[model samples]
Target: MRLVVAITGASGAIYGVRILQMLSALGVESHLVTSRHAMLTLTTETDWTPEGLRSLATHVHPVGDVGSVIASGSFQHDGMIIAPCSVKTLSGVANCYADNLVTRAADVTLKEGRRLVLVFRETPLHLGHLRLLTQAAEMGATVFPPVPAFYHEPKVIDDLVDQTAGRVLDQFGLDAAVARWEGMRPLRERQDQQPDHQAALGEPVNG
Candidate 1:
């Protein structure tokens, strides 16, 4: 387990932070690279400082350091993940534009045939967004949007974040304690367990 992780200028900076924390807990080697705007998002969206975020990774590379080890295909690693991947970064990856370290590493990941997971954080996408995502997928990148699931019944924001991060790790075959979706209960069983909505609301239940 060695992985390259990039945090781009997306709203959910916490996704990248959670992934780093989990990777550290799992004793995985993580090479982190954060964009300038990602640092701003980290501070704006969460209390985590750039220094704190750097401490979670085994190594931290500057966003412009295209000559870094992870930028080359020969730097054998398990995979790369661009958590909270911005559409700008997505475009770069889709177009094989290696202007920055994040895109460069992603390019190398695809060229090396290693797993490249993009935790895209945009919503209400237009045709161009879809096209870019499709192109990246065709190039072997996993475009994973951080869509929250309620099957585990999240009680807090952190739970939702953890679930998304865990699911991302799942793509790399790492277990982050994500709630697996088992077969649903039988319809009759579910109905039997359902509470009386009218009674709960203090309304008289019809016979």
Candidate 2:
């Protein structure tokens, strides 16, 4: 599967890295783009350089290189994910203002009726942010903020990123490598565990 993974100037750079690592492990082709501010934020927050990130992608292109293949809907990508999508980028996408290749690719993804996942990484959001998100959603984009549920009992920051990435990957039929939450306790009994019990032809036990 061809996946376009973009990193913007958001604090959760690790989410973008985790997405790249998982996509590589799953043998999905990753086309990467990082905005200038994104590189600055990455180096300030993480160990990888812009070149280091380029090494992870099958094809890495400049943010301004609108001539890149992905700028066109015919390039045939399964999806596009802006992990750690910055509010700036989100606004651009929301308005269909393809000032650069990142926004153009996202526009292409939406126009083609393919999946576009924006891992919006802003907090203390204002009403403007909500309005932008609503606009993006109305345009058939999935606005996935970097929020994880506590019910999953995430142990580390990576755990939270993985769970969210996994959920995002589900839309593309890619495994996020995070364990699924079956919403029940594990079944075990003296070395013989029963299959997960879903209600059958009886009065359901709400266990």
Candidate 3:
């Protein structure tokens, strides 16, 4: 499978790294791009060197390359992901602002009726943010906020990261990580186990 992965100037650059690792593991080829701000964020938030980013994708295009193949709807890809997608990139995609290849790729993904998953990372959204997200949703872009799941009983940061990446991959019909959403014992098992778990945290267990 082929996918386009864009990293923007969001706080969590680690998600981008993890997504690349997961995609590589699944043998999915990635066309990767990162904004100037995203590159800067990597320096500040991660130890990702230039070589590390290059190693993640089959082809790495500059963010300014609007004429790149992935930017056109004619280029067929299984899906696209903007891991740790910033609000700026989200707004650019939502408003049809295809000034750069990343946004253009996003626009193309929506127009082509392919999966476009945006891992929007901004928090405490105002109406403007909500509006842009709604617009993107209306255009068939999947607006996935990077929220953790308690149901998974996550014990580490990697667990949460993998679960979210797995969900994103599922949008493309690709299983990149553990199937966190399937193969449950039953709803009764969850309900039966929740009381003890919640009680340990001194919280009310509502089944």
The candidate that achieves the highest TM-score relative to the unseen native structure: 1
Off by over 4 Å in 3: 179-207
Judge candidate 1 at residue 107 and give its lDDT: 95
TM-scores of all candidate predictions against the true structure: 0.92, 0.86, 0.86
Error of 2 at 119 (Å): 0.4
The most accurate candidate by lDDT is 1
Return model 1's CA RMSD, one decimal.
Answer: 2.0
Question: Rank order by lDDT, top first?
Answer: 1, 3, 2
Clashes (N, CA, C under 3 Å) per candidate: 0, 0, 0
Residues 126-182, model 2: lDDT tens digits:
999999999999999998887886656667877777888788888888776686766
TM-score computed on alpha carbons, candidate 2:
0.86
RMSD of candidates 1 onward, in order = 2.0, 7.9, 3.7
Between candidates 1 and 2, the lDDT winner? 1
Which 10-residue window of candidate 1 scores lowest in summed lDDT? 176-185
The candidates, ranked best first by TM-score, are 1, 3, 2
lDDT per residue (tens digit) for residues 131-195 in model 1: 99999999999989999998776789999999999999999899987777787889898778778
Worst 10 residues of 2 by lDDT: 187-196
